[model samples]
Every structure is written in C-alpha cells, then in structure tokens.
Target: MSTTTKTNHIGRKISRIRELRGMKQETLAEVMGISQQSISHIENSETLEAEKLGKVAKALGVTKEGIENFSEENVINYFNNFNDNSFSNSQGTFNANNCTFNPLEKLMEVVEENKKLYERLLKAEQEKNIYLEKLLGK
Candidate 1:
C-alpha cells in the first residue's frame, strides 16, 4: 500500500476556518478590503504570499501560525473533547446558579410592559383631546 501524505494547503485552511466561523467570502473580502473574486482566487490557490496570508489571517480573526497549523481533524477533535464544565470547577469564582432568570426573557417582558404602557398613555391622550374639543365646541 502506498502512503500518501496530505498537503498543507493554507488557502483551503483559511476557507474552512472562514466557513466554520459563519463568515461569507464577501464579508471577509470587505474586512480585508479586497474583492469577492480575490477571496475566491485565494481560496482556489494552494499557496499564498506571506503578506497576503498575514492580512487574510487578520481578516479571519486568526494568527498566521493558526492558519498554518489549522486542520479539520484537529478542529473535530477539539469539538469532540470540548466541555463547558471547565467554567465552573471547585472554585467559587464562577457560579452558574447565580443567574436566577434568563436575561433575554426578562428583557422581552420589559419590552411588552413598555408597549402596553405606551398604548394606555396614547389612549389617555386621545380621550383628553376629545374632551378639550367638546369643551371648545360649547
């Protein structure tokens, strides 16, 4: 059996990382001040210049070394071994139970209350205007 080694294609790595980060090519191009065609050409290329690579790294929010060392297998392994429990260990610094309510839900409730209050205030103003109009008619 022949053992074929995988080539370290930096462009592919950048494309993959950008995709994983939920960024479109146009977005990356805008961030790098380049055109979408340029981004596409870069992704299609197997190699890139150091300066261009540095700029791409910055646009992609990764270090040059990170781009060079990126691999699908490594990313998969990282996600597979990822754990959220590290945020709260035996240390008292972090307490997950400290948040008694969902902030988003609370904000929604406040928004709804404000909307109701605004409607009530609008109705009261309309009634006052109607009363003033009736008094002036006399």
Candidate 2:
C-alpha cells in the first residue's frame, strides 16, 4: 500500500471560499479594484504573494489564515452539524411546532403581488398606446 498526501493549493482554496460566499469573479474583482481577468489568473495559480493574498482575503471578507486553511470537507461538516442542531433543543429533543410560518403561503403572496403589479403596468402601457394613436390620427 502507498501513502497519499493532499496538496494544499492556495488558489483553489480562494476559489472555493469565493464560491461558498456566493461571490462571482467580477464581484470580487470590483471589491479588490482588480480586473476579472486578474481574478481568473489568481484563482488558477497554486501560490500567491503575501500582499496579494492579504488583499484577496480582505476582499473575500475572511482572514488570510482562513483562506490558507480552507477545506471543502470542513465546510460540509460544519453545515451538517449546524443543521443537526437547528431543529433540536438543549436536551436533543426535536420540536415540531418551531416553524413560525408556512413557506408556501409566503411564496404565493409574493407571486400574487407580482401578478397585480404586472397587470397594472400593462394597463398603463395600453392606455398610453391608445392616446398616441388618437393623436396620430388627428
């Protein structure tokens, strides 16, 4: 049997952290005052300079050490543990009555509001078109 070692690629860590934060290359670039092409280059490199790494960390809203030590497995484990704790009490009891509101009802409310807004806008546009046509006919 052979031993295997994981390679710690700084660029890959940065890319993963950026993705986890729901950030796009363009967004990070804008925050760092760099171009999207530059962000792409940084994400492809295995290593980065100290100053550049600091800037990237700041732009991503994490410490430099945080980015250096980032791991997908750790993130997954963290969220798994968080989810397990979210629905339980201190005595490890699940509470079924903890839900405050119905998600489907909230979604239906938003849809209905959007539909009303769209109908009003459509009616206004139709009235404007009718007025323009009457003027053109004169």
> Best-fitting candidate, measured by TM-score?
1
Off by over 4 Å in 2: 83-138
Instruction: Encode model 2's per-residue lDDT on 30-122: one tens digit a residue.
Output: 999989999999999999999999999999999999999789887776556565336433467464446689999999999999999999999
- Residues 55-136, model 1: lDDT tens digits: 9999888999999999988888665654553342234334334667899999999999999999999999999999999999
Cα deviation of 100, candidate 2, in Å: 19
Candidate 1 segments whose C-alpha is farther than 4 A from its true place: 87-138
The local distance difference test score of each candidate is 0.88, 0.89
Report lDDT (Cα) of residue 74, candidate 1. 80
What is residue 113's positional error in candidate 1, in angstroms? 26
